[model samples]
Target: MTTTTRTAVVTGAARGIGAGVAKRLAADGFAVAVIDLDEAACKPVAEEIEATGGRALAVGVDVADEQGVQAAVDRIAKELGEPTVLVNNAGIIRDNLMFKMTADDWDAVMNVHLRGSFLMTRAVQGYMTKAGWGRIVSLSSTSALGNRGQANYAAAKAGLQGFTKTLAFELGKFGVTANAIAPGFIETEMTAATAERVGMPFEEFKKAAASQIPVARTGRPADIAHAVSFFVSEGAGFVSGQVLYVAGGPKA
Candidate 1:
């Protein structure tokens, strides 16, 4: 929110929604840090930002690792200036019916979606508070409402809604706001994987999903990005502790 140097850090920015968000924030005039587990995978996104005459940095980090997350944040602050905007978009899916789910599957989802968000937010909040202004947006999903094979994912995402609200309450005095975006049926690599897991062609899966939505179309990464852009914008300072359902219909 500071006009001097608005650096944004977006996790899982190598591809999909994270990448889209990184690009959008860059265009919004923030010095963006494109972070992913594979630093190499993050290069293309950062490079694309640079090509468009925006500043960006590619950093490799496992968001659930305490040391890794702290180190990545320190580096971003030094390289791109203090990160006042943090997008916790790094997540994984381990979908299974409860009877078929393994403990590992459950832990994996929690570690990435819950623990990862915790670590990343902990690391970045200091800069935001120091700047006296910030925005934190975590990606939730319609699955948080309950999906057939996503018990673990649903729990983790639901947990994030609470996390965002708590952050909003705790950080409001520092001019920091936190909100969650629960997207529905977004067309991304993750959704493609879901389609494969369900033995449906990706195109057919999109069509089937679109048919049930009021918008009559599957959501795109850019759609999520647009919502995020609003949350992080200067005008959204009063908005916090909200879970925005970006589903095509009235899902919330």
Candidate 2:
């Protein structure tokens, strides 16, 4: 009841963590904009929310495209209401050792993770500023802590942390809080792909990963969603500019 019917824009929401965050926000009383690279791909998540009697809208967005991002925000504003919550969750991985990493690989990761977040946030903040209340959450990763063969990804994810803090510094006066969620070992298509890249069965990979964690388990999208749920809640207004490492014990 505290969040009203504020709109929340979650990028890369077609599946995985983005979808989880979008679904959770809708349940938390926000009309969610389920955004991804393909509008059609976004429909299922939006439809699922609507089936649960929550409001949702599907949008296609190339977060790195400035004009496309602006247009997407405008559409979400006109259709679902002005978006007061923004989640920069869209990203891709081009993992390789620095020796074999290409410029294209680096650019692809940076464009989606950094430039995309930059573009989407820039487009949506106006609505938040006008309302004087907002929550901006970006997805960071444990990989940001200097993972091997992930130079580009590590840099991009690390960049999001800085971005979150800066937004907090500049937007706190507007009653907008910014935070980042750095997740570890979440089971998703992306993680599955990582396992495949290493020619390891996902179950075996998960088992190996779980053994390293104090919790002796992997994470799910819903786990990250719960953290996001709290960060965007009315009670979380004072909890900003923090990087929450949701990896079992500490160390991230």
| TM-score of every model versus the real structure | 0.98, 0.98
Clashes of 1: 0
lDDT of each: 0.94, 0.95
* Residue-level lDDT tens digits of model 2 in 71-188: 9899999999999999999999999999999999999999999999999889988898999999999999998899999999999999999999999999999999999999999999
List model 1 lDDT by residue over 1-252, tens digit each: 444869999999999999999999999899999999999999999999999999999999999999999999999999889899999999998888999999999999999999999999999999889989999999998988999888999999999999999999999999999999999989899999989988999999999999999999999999999999999999999999999999998985
- In model 1, pairs of residues that clash are none
C-alpha RMSD in Å of predicted model 1 compared with the true structure = 0.9
Candidate 2, pairs of clashing residues:
none
